[model samples]
Each structure stands twice: as structure tokens, then as C-alpha cells.
Target chain A: MQDFLTIDALSKYYANGFEALKSINLRVKESEILALLGPNGAGKTTLISTICGISKFTSGKITLAGHDIIKNYRAARKMIGMVPQELSLESFETVMNTLRFSRGLFGKAPNDSYLEELLEQLSLLDKRNSQILELSGGMKRRLSIAKALSHEPQLLFLDEPTAGVDVELRKDMWLLVRHLRNEGVTVILTTHYIEEAEEIADRVGIIDKGQLLLVEEKESLMQRLGQKQLTIELQNRLEELPTKLSDYDIVLAADRQSLNYTYNMRSGRTGINQILSSLTQSGIIIKDLQTKQSSLEDIFMSLVNETAK
Target chain B: MNYYGIKAIYKFEIARFFRTLFQSFVSPVIATSLYFVVFGAAIGSRIQEVDGVSYGSFIVPGLIMLTVITQSISNGSFGIFFPKFIGTIYELLSAPVNFFEIVLGYVGAAATKSLFIGLVILGTSTLFVEFNVIYPGLMILFLILTCVSFALLGFILGIWAKNFEQLQLVPLLIVTPMVFLGGSFYSISMLSPFWQTVSLFNPVVYLISGFRWCFFGISDVSITTSLLAVFSFMTLCLAIIAWIFKSGWQLRT
Candidate 1:
């Protein structure tokens, strides 16, 4: 993948002396959907604001398509589009006027055809003539996205794009984002919904407490931190683990009906065969066996806790 | 600098103003008519004349300037302040439009509204009393300058204000006093000599004098001094706004 945007040594300090961002460095490649997952107060919004040139960085450099964000703000801003968390539009303005005005702000010639296409894509064509104040919350959110896309920016940043949305709407928005990616746009998403990221993100970056915990491919991250639980139901109840099978370090249920074995998937030697052979040699009959795999949420929580330390 | 960006924001702001035409246009007309009836007729009857001009005629320029000043400040401040207050400033800030372009679009629309209200008041004045326009060129210049200056003042106020109450402070506490003390209903010369001298410190006095000079060719302050004060205030306010836009002070974070 080719690097399309680069953020180096970024930091933000408010006038009130709050250090919201501490020296962040990240590289976003072209045509990749990168999800920035974080809990509250993790600097996700601050980082996006600084990169987009809306919030000034205390000290750092950001390059968008090789253009320095600070030195060449107009060019950098032109190449990037942002959908902020707030669904703020001129309440008195019609949907059509809002998009047209936003398009004109970029100095692009008025093209009704292009605007119509954008509105249609956003599912706002039906409400184009309606005032923003008349729209529902979901429609307003869609209008926000439409306005941002009017200029057709290459790098799109979505800050909690699906917050407070229902399951159906959320799924529709994810599909729309995926469509944008297919059209050769690079997307950077920030969300508190872990499942949203796990379902759609190609790469996941976890940030916590103003620091980047880790950035890795979603599959490899799971493989690296994932664990497994193997449960065996004995044919007969037992008072305790056999003295020989105690070496396996299995936990016997309080009722003595089952044994649970926890092991790291990354470890090559789980010794499952050894445990089975030993159990059989001791005449302990096994009735059923099952295994459970760790989910992405497990990895996310551990990563957050690991960074806290 | 980008043509499309300016057009986009300009068109949006203008559309918003017109969308609220009932309040934006109708209220100003009603307010201006009331001022004419009360201040121009009631007050003008007690005061016969000022600076060799009819009292009713003399207050016309002052009334128009007052309307323009208040509208300019209100439109400019509210246009930006409400978006910020409701968290919609984020949409504008994150858009491809630069800060300068955003200001131009918003303040430009405000200035246009102020000019429209000023002209409407001027037209309404003719219905009540006869006034002459001695210097059309100077009148246009002063009208344009007043709108721009107050619009910038509103921009600063919008950025500095955190709540609706703070937004009303400058218009209520600051602008009202300036307009009333600037000689809207009476000539500064009518006050004692000491008060007339003290009035020079109020910038609105110069604006009123300059605008009045356009209609009657008579002014309490020197023409050159009035022009100089206006240009200086415009420059200073523009500089502060430009700095705020560059720093993204309150608008961004």
C-alpha cells in the first residue's frame, strides 16, 4: 500500500492547559479502511481535528497527498473531507441549497448533475427541497455526510459516524462507506462500537489515553492475542483431578462434572494429546468436548488494559 | 480565494437569511416604522431644528444608520454563533473551505442584509418626512463601510461568545449605548459644549455625522476625521478577525 497521508509528532494543548493529544505518529495508505477504536477521552477527535486543520496543532507536521497541512492549508483541506460527530446544518436551508452552497465554497463550477448524483447516493434526493429543520435525526446525519462528499475529497474522516444510530441505519451507513472505499477513496473511521470496526475495518488502530496502543491487521491482531477454552464433560462425576492428570493444570468444576482447559493458541504445544492419553489411562471417560475462540472484543479490552499499565 | 468555495458559503448563508424572511425582513420594517413614529414625530415635535435642518429630517440619517448597525451586528453574530452553539460549526470547519472563505461568505451575507435594511429604512423615511441626499457618493461609501465594520465586530463577538446570553451582550450593552449616545435623536451641538467634545470619543457619533453629512451637507465632526476613524476601526477589526481565523482560536477546538 502507498502512503497517502502522514501525521508526524502531533500534539495539542488547549489554552486551559489540557494536553489532549500527545505526540502521535501515523501513516494512512491509499484505499484502505482504517478504523480507530478508542474509549472516551482517548484523543480520537483531537487527532482528527488536528489532521483536518480545523484544530491547530501545538507541535507537529501533517502531510496530505504530499502537501503540508499547515503551509498549504487550502490544498490539504481540499483533498480531505470530514463528517464530524455533530449533525449541524443550517436548519432553515433546504437540503439542495446546503449541498450546492457547500460545493460552491470549494470554487467548483455548479454542476446540477453531480449534485443530484451525490444526493441520490446519500438517499437525500427525496428530501432535497425540504428544510433541514424538518428532517429527522437520521436524515440530518445523512445530509452531513452528503455535504462533506460534495467536494469529492480523497481522504474521508468519519468521527463516530454511527453513534446513536439504530442497527439497520448503521448497517446501511457501513455499506455506503464500503462503497466509497471501492470508488478509490481512503477512509479513516473512529468509533466506540467495536463490532462495527471488527465487521468492516481492514486494519484496526487502538488508541487509549492520548497514546496509540497498536496498529495491526485485524486478523493478525486476533491471532496474536487470541485465546481458547477447551471444555470436557466427563462421563462420571469426580471428586478431584487425578494426581497424574493434575500436571495438565485443568480447572475442575465445583460440581466435579466438567474440566475446563485454558491455553494460548499461539503456544504450539497445548498438550491436548497428553491430557487425553493420561485421562484414558486413568479410566476417566470423556463424554463430550467443545472449544470456544476469543472474539475481537477480548483483544480490544486486553489491549486497552495493557496500555493502561 | 477559491471561487466555488466562496459561492458555496455565500449562497448557503443568503439562503438561510431569506428562509427566515418573516423575521429577517418583516421585523426590521416594523421596528423601523415604530422608531419613526415615536422618535422622529414625537421627539421631533419637541425639538424644532438642529444644524439649520428640520428635526424630523435630521434624524432620518441617524435612524437608518442605527438599523443598519444593529442588523449588521445581529446577522453577523447569529449566523456564526448559532452554528457553533449547536455544534454545526464542525461542518463548516471540516469542510474544504478555508477560514477566510468561511468568514467572507458569512459576513458578506450579513453586510448584504444590513444594506437591505438600511435602504428599506431610507425608503420608509421618505413616507414620513422629506429629506435631501446632497452627496450620493458619500452616502453609499458610508453605508458600505458601516455594514462591513459592524459585521466584523459581530464576527469577533460570535467567536468570543460561549452562550446565547454572551452573544446578546455586545448588541445590548455595547451597541445600544453607542447608537443612543451617538446623537440619533439630537445633534451633538445641542448638548453642552463639554458634552459635545466628549461625544467625539464615541465612534458611532462619527458614523452618524458622516451619514448625516451625506443628506444635509452639515456635520458635527470634520468629514476627514470621520472618514479616518471609520477606516481605522474597519482595519483594526479586520486584523483581529483575520488573526482569529488564522489561529482557529474558538472556532476550531
Candidate 2:
């Protein structure tokens, strides 16, 4: 089965001898939102640039809809669009002219109606005649997305599309990404915010230190990595763990008021029964019990720490 | 082919040039006319004629060369350099168009802008002196070739420039001195024999002589050598540009 976008062992080594991207392999299914989560200098932008053929890769292959990004670049590029990490725009051009010009660069016929529709969709209708420099940071970013989508590309790369915007604009971008995905526009977005992936990505790929650490479905990755904590409210403040409860991974709360047992939910038999029975056998009275599943942020931090080692 | 891509980039650059009309077009014309007034009044009386042409008319061809060369180079460099500086080049590189088309769009627009300036300076010069073009066709030919070749050189300089100061380096340091020393203000024959030989080695001499020949039917070197020299230099600049794009030098990082 041919993926919509396939990166096979794509590697890029800068002339300064800094390896920006290690041997990376990734396959993005058609119409899926694949959130690329990584920390800074994690080769996320490098991978996107190399795939777009802006930065030449030292080795490996990138194919967009069955065409090589290098050899069949024109055909391959026509199927892709990129919203760069930087807010790079032709500052003097009006939103309309820039969109028309960008679409024309892909050899696409001039379609003012389509551009007008795009403007309306992006809420840029009022700013169509405005020069890019006059637009605010949020508007400029929307124009970047509009320009990237002007050619009606099949695959889109949004490199930190919502990196620095306010919460409102970030929500707007997430909605926009969801809209694109609904229209079957395959999206690959890189972000450091784990909650972003949690909100919209169908799948998530974690990358760090120039290498891809893992790629898994959003639901599965959550279930596989998420930890469940069982908090037992003590009838009385406890000083330490008893010998009977020593076998479990448990910690006393800061107030010395409760026992917090941390265990991976993926591993069956969360040791709830064992801890509960041991507590009863030890003659400790429990006021109440509560369970909490860790969020994606904690999982991401642990994953990054795991790879750093 | 990417004609649309070429046209888009060309329009983008041409629009940029027009936005700064005073700086891009008018300043050079005003400066060139002042040269005619000062040099024609101050130096004209001292030396009556250069090769039977009035001293005022004598420098017209060289003046055009100097202004056109510098205008094209600076415009070409700045047009591309600003995009790179502001990070718009990535948008260009990521587009579907090839490098050659990108270069053609930029170099073509730069050449066109400089050609218009060259003709404007020519029209302005006619206001000051009465001169006839010996071969109007060849005159336009040399003017256009000079604009294009210098524009190409500017493209190379733009990519190689790390900063704005470096962007002006070639036009100010190298091209200006070469044009001045290449018989712009005086005839090479007025020099001592040794200096005359040294002037013969300056590449701008061939360009000026060929251009001047189109005006007065007088030249310092045979017309063929002049043509060969300009074309060869243009070809060399083209080769360097091709190499730069192929290696992704300064463009890809």
C-alpha cells in the first residue's frame, strides 16, 4: 500500500558537520492528521524542508503520491504545500496578489473564485487587498496557510503553525487543521505542545535528537504509555510504608496523608487488589480511594527523558 | 518552462523596484546629470575634444556604462538579498519552479529595470549635448547586454553576500574603480604609453570602447574583441550562477 507521503531513511547532514536529521523513516496515511511532537532542535523542521526539497538531503528517499521529491520534483511538489516555521511572506504583496502568484508558481491556472473562497474560509476576506506587512502576526500566519493551500495541494506540512499565537488563534488553527483533514488534505504538523496533538492528531510521532523515537496511533499510544495512580486517603497520617506494602511502587503524599500507587495501565492487574489486600492485612484503615490517569504531557516528558538517556 | 512562475517572480521584483521610485530610478538619473554639468563645465574647457568628439559627449557612453552596470548589479543583489534576509527565499525554493526559472525571473527583472535607467540617462544626456548614434541598433544591443551581464554578476553577489555591506562591495569597490579607470573621463591615448598598456588590460575598457563605438564610430579596440569580451564574461557569470544553484551553495542549509 502506497502511503500519501513516505520518507525512507531520509538523512541530512549540514556542511558544518551538524547532523540535523538522522536516518528517519515515516509513512503518513492519506487524510490523517499526524502531529509531529518534538522539542527544539529535534530535526522536525529539517525533515519537513528536506521532504519539500528546499534543503537537500544527504541520503534517502521522499515520495509524494508516488513521485520522487527530487527527480519528479515538479509533479511531486505540485501535490504538496508547506507553511514554514518562520512567518516568511512577500511583505509588499497584497493577500490576493500573493495568493494568485503562489498558485501560479505551481503552474495552476488563475482561479480568482477559488482564491476568493479560500479568503473567505480563512476569514481573510476583509484583508484580501491589504499588504502582508499591514496584517497582524495572526493574519500573516493565516495568509501563509492560505498561500500554502493556494495551489490545492494534496499533502500539507505545517511547521509549528501555532507556535507563538494566543489561545484563541491556536484554537482557530486547530479547527483549520481539522477542516483540512475533513477535506482529505493530509496534514503533518510539528509542535512541542503535547496537548495540541492530544486535541486533534489522529496519530502522533515523537521525534528527538534528530531521530524519530516512535510513531503510533493517538489512542494506542495513550493507552500504552499512560500511568494510572491510585490514591488511598488514610484514616490517619502515616509516616512511612509498611513492610507488607513495600513491594508496590507507592509514595506518601506531601501531607503524609495518603498513599499514591503509580502503575502502568497497559500492564494488566494494576496491583489495585494486591495493594488493597495488603493494606487491609496491615490493619490500616482507608478513608477513601481515587484513581487518576496521567495526561499526554507527562507521557511526552517521560518519552523525551527516556530518549535523552 | 514555468512561464507563470517566471512572470510572477518578475512582477514581484518589478513591483518592489517601482515602490522605491526615487531611490531606484530617479536618484541615479539626477546624479548622472550632475556629472555632465560639473565634468562638462570643469573638464570640458581644459580638454577640447576626445577623439574629435566634444569632451561632454565623450563621457556619455562611459557614463551610461558606469550607471547601468552599477544600477543592474545593485538592483539584482538587493532584489534577491532582501528576500533571503527576510526569509522569503524559502517560500521561493519550496515552490515548484526550478532554479533556472527563479534566476531568469530575478535577472530578467533586474536587467529590464537597468535598461530603462540606461535609456533615461541617455535621454537626459541628449538634453545636455548634441550627439548622434553611429549605429543605433548596436548601441541598444551593447546597452542591453551590459545590463543583463551585470545583473547576472549581481545575482551571484547577492547569494554570496553574508550582509548588506558585502552586498555593496563589488559595485562600489571593484566595478566603480574599473569603470573610472577604463577611460570614462579621459581617452586612454592621453595616458603615458605604459599606462595605456595597463588600461588595455582592464575589462571595462572593452565594454566602454564597444559601447562608445556604437555612438561615434570610434573605438579603442576592434569591435570583435569587445563583443567577445562582453559575451565571454556574461557566459562566465552564467556558469557561476549555474554552479551555485547546483551545489545549493548559500541557498540550502
Candidate 3:
């Protein structure tokens, strides 16, 4: 896929000399879902703002669909849509009017059918005529999505789209994001919810303290950094871990009923069979065994922790 | 040119104005009627004439100018300020439209609104005073120039203001007083020489003088000077707006 959006060595420094964004480089491929995962004040919003032309970057270049964001901003901005984190809306305006206003502001011809379809997809058709103030928090979030997509932008930036949303709505939002991706709309979403990125992101970018720590394929990152744990449930209670298991990264459960063995996924030999054989030889009767793969959240925490050091 | 973008913003602002019809349109008309009652009927009964025009009629142009100037600033400032206050300005900043289109939309809507109110006030004033517009074309020209220029100033104020108090500060403290003391109810000639010279320093004087000339062919300053003042004020506003857009001052961080 072609690189639809590129950020080359972008840096932003405030007048007071606080660096909001480091010299960052990133390229978003067309029709891909890129999730930016970061903690509070991690420059996720700053990066998105700079890319969307809301903030003036101190240095470097950004281009959208081959147009320089600074020099040809109109052309670049025309192809992009952003749903901000705050649910800021014209409280008196109806949902339909909001969509119409956004579409028109993006220089797109009014297309009622397209907007209606968007509302329907987001389950907001029933509330089209309802004023924004009358809508619930979840409904407002949906409206924000509808508004952002009203112009049919080739690239969409969802800045914490599911923040404060209920679990059901968050799931629906994930589904909508996937649907948008299937329609060939590239998506860049910043999220504190690791599960959101784990569920829908094609690629994940972890940023901390105004610096991007890494950007890699989600699956590859999981494979490279993910750890697997094997649990040996013992039928008989063990008072202590036999010295034989100490070398294998195994720990005895506090209740003395199970043994846990940790192993790196990338290693060729997990030593699972050896550990099981050792357990059997040590007269620890195994009732059953189970394994668990570390979730993206675990990987994310470790990565952020590494940077904090 | 992004005509659609400008139109969208303009229509959005106009719709908001209509939504608050009583506050935006009717309130000013009511206020103008009260002004006519106090200044035109009560006060005019004592001072029968000023500069050969009936006292009631003479204050007509100044009244319209006052409403137009203040309304233009209020509407223009609130139009942009509300969006910023509510955090919806992100859409405007991120939209494909440029600064020119933005000004055209916001300032255009604000001017149109003040123009409507100004014209309505003119009609309402006629109920209280006998009036005639000698140069109807020039009257409209001055009306529009005032609306556009002041609306532009309001846009600057809206961007520069950090809070609601700051937003209302200039229009309330500076603009309203300037309009009242700019010879809105009386000609500068009514004042002594020292005060007359002081009134000349007020920029609103040129606007009122120009607009009054449109009604009765009488003005404290030459028509050319008034026009020059209007243009200069407008140019200054446009220059500030241009700088705001260029430097991303207040509007962008």
C-alpha cells in the first residue's frame, strides 16, 4: 500500500520551550488502521493536532496524499477528518445540521443520502433531528464520528473516540472503525485503551513523553515481545519448589497447588515438555495444565516501563 | 476559493442568529424603540432642533449607527467566541478553508445580521420621528461599511479574548462609550471648542458623521474624510486579521 500520510522529523516546541513533540517520523499506509497508544501528556494529541494543522509545528514536514500540509494545507486538509477527544458540539444544532455543516465546511457538495447512510451506520438516524444537547454522551460520541465521516475523508483521525463510552458503544465504535477501514479509509486513532488497539489496530505505535518508542505490526510486536506462561496444576500440595525447577523460571503458587513457568515466545525451545517431565519426576502429580499468552496490555506496559527507566 | 466552505460557516452563523431571534434581532429593535422614546420624544421635546433638522430626525442616523456598530461587534465576537469557548473551533481550524474564507463567513454573517437590525431600527425609528434619507445609496454604503468594518474588529476581539469577560470588555467599555460620546445624540457643534476638538479624536465620530450626512446632507467632517476614516479602520482590521492568520496568533497554538 502506498503511504498516504507521512510525517518527516516533525518537532513542536512551545514558546516557553516545552517540547510537545520530538523529531518524529511516521508513514501511514493507505487503508490501514494505525493505533497510537500513549499515556497522559504523551504528545499523542499534540502529534495529531500538528498533523491536522490545528497546531503549528516548530519544524519538519508533513504531507497528506502528496500535498505538503503546511504549504498546501487546504488540499491536504480536504482529504482528512478529525474527531476530537472532547465532545464539543453546537448544543443547539440538530444532528443532521451538524453533518451538513461539517460536510460543507470540508468543501464537499451536500449529499443527504451519504450523510443519512452514515447516521444509520452509527445508529443515529433516529436522532437526526434531535439537538446535540438532547443526545446522551454515547450518542454524542456517535454523532462526532458521523460528523467526521460526513465529508468522506480519505483519512480519519479518531482522538480517543471511545473515551468515557460504555462497553457496548466502544465495541460498536470498534466495529465502525473496522468498517471504515474495509472501505479503504485510513484511520489513525489515539487511545489509552490498550484493548481497543489490540482489537482493531493493524499497526500499533507506542509513544511516551513526546517521543515515539516504536511503530510495528501488531502481530509481529506481540510475537517478538509477548511472553507465555504455563501453569501446572498439582493434585497434591507442594510445600516448596524443588531445587530442580528453580533454573527454569518456575515459581510455586502461594497455595502450593500449582506451578507457573514463564517463557519467551521468540525462543525456539519453550522447555514446556522438560518442565512437565521434571514435575512428574519430582512426584508432583499434575492434575491439569494450562497456558496463557500475554495480552497487548502487558506488552504495552512493559514497553512504557522500559522508557520510564 | 472554497465558496462552499464560506457558505457553510455563514449559513451556520446565520442560523444561530435566527435561533436566538429575540436576543439577536428583536432585542435590538426594542432597545432602539426605547432610545427613540427617551432621546427622541422626551429629550427632543426640550431641544426642538439641531442644525436645522428636527431633533427627533437628527438623531436617527446616529441611533442606527450605534446599533449597527455595537450589534456588529457583538454578533461578530460571539459568533467566533462561542465556538472557541465550547471547544468546537477545532473543526474550523482543521477544515480545508483558509483564513480569508473564515473571515468571509463569520464577518459576512455578522454584518448581514447587523444590517438587518440596523434597517429594522430605521423602520422602527420612523414611527417616532419624521425622517428622510437624502442619499439612500450612500446611506446603505455607510451602513454596510460600518457593519463590515466593525464586524471585522469584532472578529479580532473574538480571537484575542481569552474568556467571556474579555470578550465583552472592549465592546462594553470602549465601543459603547465611544459611540455615545461620538455625537450620537448631538452634533459636535453643540459642544464647546475644546470638547469639539476632543470629539474629533473619537473614530466613531467619522462613522456617525458620514452616516448622518447620508440622511440630512449635514456632517461635522467632510464626506471624503469620513470615507477615508472608514477605509482606514477597515484596512487596520484586515491587516490585524491577516497577521493573526499568518502568525497563528490566538487562533492556533
Winning model by DockQ: 3
Query: lDDT-based ranking, best first?
Result: 3, 2, 1
- Candidate 1 RMSD to the correct structure: 3.9
Predicted candidate 3 versus true structure: per-residue lDDT over B1-253, tens digit per residue: 9988999999999999889998898888999899899988998888968778999899999999999999999988998999999999999999988888999999999999999999999999989999889999999999999999999999999999999999989998999999999989999988999999999999999999999999999999999999999999999999999999889998889
| Chain A fold similarity by TM-score, each prediction | 0.80, 0.81, 0.81
Can you write out model 2's per-residue Cα lDDT over B1-253, one digit (the tens) per residue?
8888888889878888888889999999999999998887676767788889999899999999989999989988887898899997877888888878988899999999999999999999999888999899999999999999999999999999999999977788998999999988777788899999999989999999999999999988988999999999999999999898889899987
Docking quality class, candidate 1: medium
Q: How well docked is model 3, in DockQ terms?
A: 0.88
Each candidate: chain B TM-score:
0.96, 0.97, 0.98
User: Each model's DockQ?
Assistant: 0.67, 0.71, 0.88
Q: Lowest-scoring 10 consecutive residues by lDDT in candidate 3 chain A?
A: A295-304
**Model 1 chain B weakest 10-residue run by lDDT:** B90-99
Clashing pairs in 2: none
Instruction: Tell how far residue B130 is off in model 3, in angstroms.
Output: 0.8
lDDT of 3 by residue, A153-245 (tens): 999999998888889998898999999999999999999876788889999998877898889998876565558988889998999888777
**Candidate 3, which CAPRI tier?**
high
Q: RMSD of candidate 2 to the true fold? A: 3.9
The order by descending TM-score is: 3, 2, 1
